[model samples]
Target: MAFTLTFALIAALAGPSVAESRDELEKKKNGVNSEITGAQQSYDESSKAAGDAAAVLQASQAQLADAQANLGSVRGQLVAAQALDAQMQAALAQSEADLAQAEADLAVGEQNVEASTKEVISFSVESLQSGDPGLRAFNDLMNGANPTEFTERKAISDTIADVQLDRLDTLDATRVILDLNEQKVQALRDQVQVERDAAAANLANITVLEQQAAAQEASVAQLVQANSANKAAADAAVAEDAALISALEADRARLEAEIQAEIARTTPPPATGGGGGGGGGGGGNASGKLSYPLDSVRLTSPYGYRIHPISGVRRMHDGQDFGSPCGTPIKAAADGTVISQYYNSGYGNRVILNNGVINGVNIVTTYNHMSRFAVSPGARVSRGQVIGYVGTTGASTGCHLHFMVLVNGSHTNPANWLP
Candidate 1:
């Protein structure tokens, strides 16, 4: 009898030990599974980050290409300006040469006229002082010149005078031409100077472009480094996830072994039907009057501080946006009467629902961005009833239900209350 008692006591202690071991294994398995899930989430986030980095790198590369193109354009302009400067210089040189030739011709003409005048004066003195008649006549003939001779002499003198005059005239014309040429030369010089200045400016711009390109290259390098880091992080996360999954598999195997062992040890266990009966009690006194607007959908904005997306300025979002599609249905969150539903500047199409009391607190909901309103001012509404259709109208990006819950005119995040 003592032996039987000892055997029964040992069996009882061993049975509990087996059960405890199984339970511990199950717990470990669950912990491992959790770890695996966490690791997978981390891996996914890291992968997304790597993808974003790659996208940024691609954008940077495109920007670099554009910068290089602009640099090439600037260089082309500089080259064109230099070519224009060279052409202007050639024009100026030709103009100077023509001017010099004109001046030289004028000087030679003046010298020839002076020599002719002296020869005529010497001949005239010799004719008037001669002693012999024939000699005197000859001198007189030489000086006065007979009809034919004088005519010929006069013609020669006239020719000389005309030559001188023509030379003088040529000089004057040449001077005029020189003046024009000089003006042209000055103009060409000015043009060349302008071109040179433009080239210099372009060179400066090129330098700036080069610097900008260098900066962009540096930025690209930085992006590359960032991308590399992101990729490494992603790889690490993947490796960690793999390790966690392997660990979970091992833990599951251990749990199965323990559970099998527990089954083997337990035999002919007493069955208490299907466990304990689930107890339930009836009840009650649940009575409360819920007074709230049902289909009130009118409100332009909500009361709260919000940052402007583009400007990054912090301002109060006075109301909510509620306008939907042209004929979309709008609903009221609670039972309330519509206080006002009118078009305003900020609120294109608006509706305001005043919920009397929700959980012992007076509440008001505003809906904006509505296409049209089914109810009018002072209209009653019920909960979960369609009041209006959603429409994207007035200061709205798209059709969305802009629901707002206000407590005493103060705005709160609608996401917290809406189901």
Candidate 2:
């Protein structure tokens, strides 16, 4: 959020060392304006930084969300891989059991074949040893017993050889079955290994995604913190600027009040006699003229619109300036009451004398840039009475007297009333 300070320049207060002169008032107002401008610049910079931080935080949050989603997806894949691995392990176990059974059966079949072969060998040896070449066997075969017993004995020897051959054939078939079982077990083990590798790869991906999410979240937090601080600084600068403007306005109000009070005090009393020394209206003659306030009068500046020396802006020169040395006695123009004695920035040491109304005009004469005051407020004096001494006390370049004539609280040409 952005805020601007919109305040008017304040008038100078009526205080000692305050802007008692127009030059000083202008300088003071400009100073405050410069401060306001500086603060506004600072606020703008801070606001921009906060805006940038907000953008960064938003992007970081989006990245974090993406990372978190990826992590979740990878974790799911890992779980599936792990489940597949478990199933493969179970199958491998079953295949291994079948392979073990086939091995045991083959071992038993070999033992049976060995024992049968041994029995046949023993019988053959006995038969060979008992006869000379073929004599005993032939005699037994020809005259041992009845034909049925001989035939049975010869069948037993033939059956023994056939049985041995069958046992060998059975052993070969069992070996083939065991080899096939071992192949099945090896395939299952390979499948389990593949599933385990897949699971490991999935787990690694999940870990990487988790780390990315954490880093993105941390970046988001830092952005948020910086944004908060920037916003605070902007707010503080704006508030301070507002406070300064308010103070300036208050000072202006106080000065206005003082000016109004001075005006009220200088309002002249009702007219009475035409002219008299020590009375309210002095310096009036058959010609009806007011006395000169200064003896050595050199008009340094005139009344009316002119460019200000310091401000360089055209403004009303409300008073007339007289070139005079410091400590030059400034006398009253007429018999009047000193209604106001105060200090002003534009008019350093000032005195406002109220000369009673003459020719239906309420005459108020102001003397400015005085080095010192010889009289106090409410003092009554005749024409030519010294009220103050001339000096460059207020917003002036050199010693001089600034004289003004106010008719009914408004300024008028002093030349019209001067003799």
Candidate 3:
């Protein structure tokens, strides 16, 4: 019944949040939809570089999210405006129908009033010209000379008396009913006009809302465009990195065997009266210590399953991504020896550190996508020792470190192990 709708009402119709006048809201919504169509195409083509698109996508997502929010607010207003228009139109229709019925009843009542007046007029005219029939019947009954004649006259008088009162009552009732119907008809006409005016106003407001749907944007796309640099960097990193990605998928057993051997070595007995070489860290006993592989940890991606940005493949993401630029120092998480340092078309320059058992389990950590190695195999590095420099040499995008941790030689969540 309320004639006005506010931003809150629009939210109820569109969703549960946002605030703005209807026109501005509608315009932003249209802009949001268009922006998404364009952005999706860009994202798909950029993501084709072997999952590198995912790295830069985080960088580019802010603007697009804002656009969507603006659109959501506007979309709600349009629905609310349309709904109000419906209410106004329905009210106008009901008013018009009521007006028509009242007019029809008034017309019928007027005819009945006129007919009743004519019947009363006819009786008055007949009385003036031919005298009163009821009075004459009464006189005949009073002058009756025989008992049988008197009885017949009395019966005729009684009938005329009853008919006279009935005729007058009909005339009075008809006039009163006619007057009341006339008043109802006038009131209905006034209500119809009021509703008609309201409906017109509602329609005009809707037209304005529709026009505003073409609203312009000033700087919404700039945020998403800023991601180009990061996206390009990711592309170059993954160019031949599919080999590394495929190795992880198909050559898992071979890689694990080599790693297991390096971490299982015992310290050789002092080499026959010579300075001992670096001892291999065979992780088995608990030392109750672990640290972040990078000095600064900015987690970009967490350990879990995710759909490939472009391929839509469901796969487990086995490591945590730290936003470390290329050349950032990779450090040892615990006092342990290097498991291995190697390079291949599949795995870019990488190193694994065996941080001997902590919390009653053997812990091995790998730092991947490094620019170069800083430690030799079997080096007994202490906690926080530089092992390698972060790089995007492997199948990845952006300059970041892909750090992985294993418990008892099975890959586990790196976050669980890192400080």
Score every model by TM-score. Answer: 0.38, 0.41, 0.36
Best by TM-score: 2
Candidate 1, residues 41-98, lDDT tens digits: the string is: 4335434444554565566567656766765666675566556656655655665565
Q: Write the per-residue lDDT of candidate 2 for residues 16-100, one digit (tens) a residue.
A: 3322323222322232333234324433443444454455546655665666666566666656666765666676566666656
RMSD (Cα, Å) of candidate 1?
19.5
Residue 253 local lDDT, model 3: 45
Which ten-residue region of model 2 has the weakest summed lDDT? 1-10
**True-structure lDDT of candidate 2:** 0.59
Residue 242 lDDT in candidate 1 = 54
- lDDT for model 1, on a 0 to 1 scale? 0.50
Per-residue lDDT of 297-380 in model 3, one digit per residue for the tens? Answer: 899988876653323333456678898879989987776655456664533677766555467665667778889989765455
Worst 10 residues of 3 by lDDT: 1-10
Alpha carbon RMSD to native, model 3: 24.4
